[model samples]
Target: MNFQTSFPSLRKILVGIHDLGRKMAAGADLSHAFIMLDGSYGGKEIASSLVDEDPNSPKGMEQLKVRKPPRQISIIRHCVNTALLANSAELDLAMGPSRKASSLDGQSRFLPVFRSGSCSEIGPKTYMEDEHICIDNLTDHLGVGADFLSPGAFYGVFDGHGGKDAASFVCNNLLKFVIEDQHFPTSLEKALKSAFVMTDHAFADTRSLDRSSGTTALTALIFGRTMLIANAGDCRAVLGKRGKAIELSRDHKPNCNVEKLRIEELGGIVSDGYLNGQLSVARAIGDWHMKGPKGSTCPLSAEPELQKTTLTDEDEFLVMGCDGLWDVMSSQCAVTIVRRELMDHNDPERCSRELVREALKRNSCDNLTVIVVCFSSDPPPRIDVPKTRVRRSISLEGLHLLKGVLDSNG
Candidate 1:
């Protein structure tokens, strides 16, 4: 069925703030399933690629150093040498296979139990040009039968530049296109990549809208134990595995290595880190000014880079936010704060609120949005560091040498 016309034109009836506690419908009437995935069905978004990202997270990570040295206590026992290699957040946890739930026989015992919370604010900025959507239960949202093998939920953050129309349009329509894609539920990666381009194209074809306005899109779609993250532009997705920060999506900043190569390859010169000495992002949706012709092979692409991972017991929560929060805090810092908050209160809403507040306190220059999706209701357990042990022994020859040295001195 062509689901393109299923959703009527809903300009901005969505809730200003969204929170998902098991269900993402808090304070909003989204029973139509049109709020997050708003297009009728198989509706489109556009062209794509990585961006010159700067916020949510940097392509370059700032490693945390431990300033406090170990106290010089008298070593009564032999011990091995040890040093703190790096912070947990600085570590890049490897991504598991993008296989189906049935393929994860080992992780079969660990299914995702989602509870999400989100907050968006016009920090120091005058206008709120950011838009986002949170749906914890896609099965219910889609009105589909309960199938453990299908997609479970969806979340997205759209950061608009030039204007809010692009962000608003993408947020409302992107997911609908994904679910309505012919490859949906079976070939998720293909469906998502196709959906991103579709949404970008759809935005470009729309009439009565400013073609110049563009937005960076970051989306997280969870199916059973498999999570597929599609990102373009700079917004980021960081997964909290236990207490460690695991980056699920890369920031598509123009300064980023891969994005830079692509920009130069497409004849798009990035001057002062801006694409073609104009836009900051290398990729985006609805920037018809930069795109020119429909399939012109422009540098400002809208096609998203997809990252897939199988969720596990160690995976605790996922944080999706715009560059505002990231400009002030490191991914490690964000994860630490969220982990501590969850351990204390186990509330995703409070965590989201706290993250926004922290960013504002740090004097963020742009609009702020953050969504914290927890996999379990239980608070994260405290991470304990194991003590390092080593046994040191002296040989008989060493003892005799010491005695001979003492005798000579006497």
Candidate 2:
């Protein structure tokens, strides 16, 4: 049963061992030799063993005589096999043989594997909330004497609650109100204030509220050299400037200092950290029920914090969203994702659609709305010069001649 007898000569032995080593290195399991040699070959198995057999020697030792040199070579070969195992392990680790090991830490890696090239809704969620409106237009006439306003003059995120009515009203009428208000100030500051107040008044009389119909208002009006933002509700306005998030609107929560004081001052208490223990609006357009009694100063007031800053070329875009979208995604995260989409497709609407889709995929339950206004468009068209209608001509020639004759007489 001596397997070694199969290859008899020294040259044959060397060739067989070398070939076996090659096969082993080529991924053959070589460790089976020890068990096969011991179990299958007995004392009388080999001719060499039978001739030199000592019946008087210790049981199995007399039958086995492995030379020291070959044994050492076998140990080295096993070590080479061990090294190969270690290298295989390292290769597996480096190459990430499994897909799970290659994923990123955050949501970026989990962006839905889009089925169709066109952006579409994943669930029941729509890219736009029913209550929100977005408008970006080039003004026909620039406001200033010499400098002209960019055609991109408007951007809005209307967040409606208790129903989409308030948001819908603002979206439909906000721009028109601003345009028609003779009282609207020439400066963005005045214009924003006028627009917000007028929008609130416009909302008050639009429809009757059965439940509690109210909305968080966040609007951005871009004019020459200025970016003006006004916000009243939980909806947010964020500017992505130089790749960072600059929050333009403050969250008017019941727990906030100013909001808490205003709610309490109006004979309302923050119950469980919510206004009257129900709503969280410190300032909102509607909620006539929460307005408290007449002659009360604490009614739901539509005061908005107006912010204005001179926009620079570094200002990439503005993100306006309802609290639904912001609840899951950080302002910077939204900005980063939207900016990436815009840079890839150069479309603001696509960016908006994706922003909402990502929010919904993140498990946001509320109505999600997002608007991205990119200020990259053709310059506004020129304004028409005012026409002058001359009714009467001044008698400048007679006056000049009379002055000349008087001087000559003198």
Tell me the lDDT of model 2 at 271: 77
Best by the TM-score measure: 1
- Per-model TM values vs. the true structure: 0.68, 0.56
Best by lDDT: 1
CA lDDT scores, all candidates in order: 0.75, 0.60
Please state every model's RMSD to the true fold in angstroms: 31.8, 27.4
lDDT, candidate 2, 46-82, per-residue tens: 3233233332356435334342124323333323346
Q: Name the weakest run of 10 consecutive residues (lDDT summed) in model 1.
A: 45-54
**List of clashing residue pairs for candidate 2:** 138-151, 266-298
lDDT (10s digit) by residue, model 1, range 217-314: 99999988889999998999999886666788888878888999998998888888888888888888998888877766878898899999988989
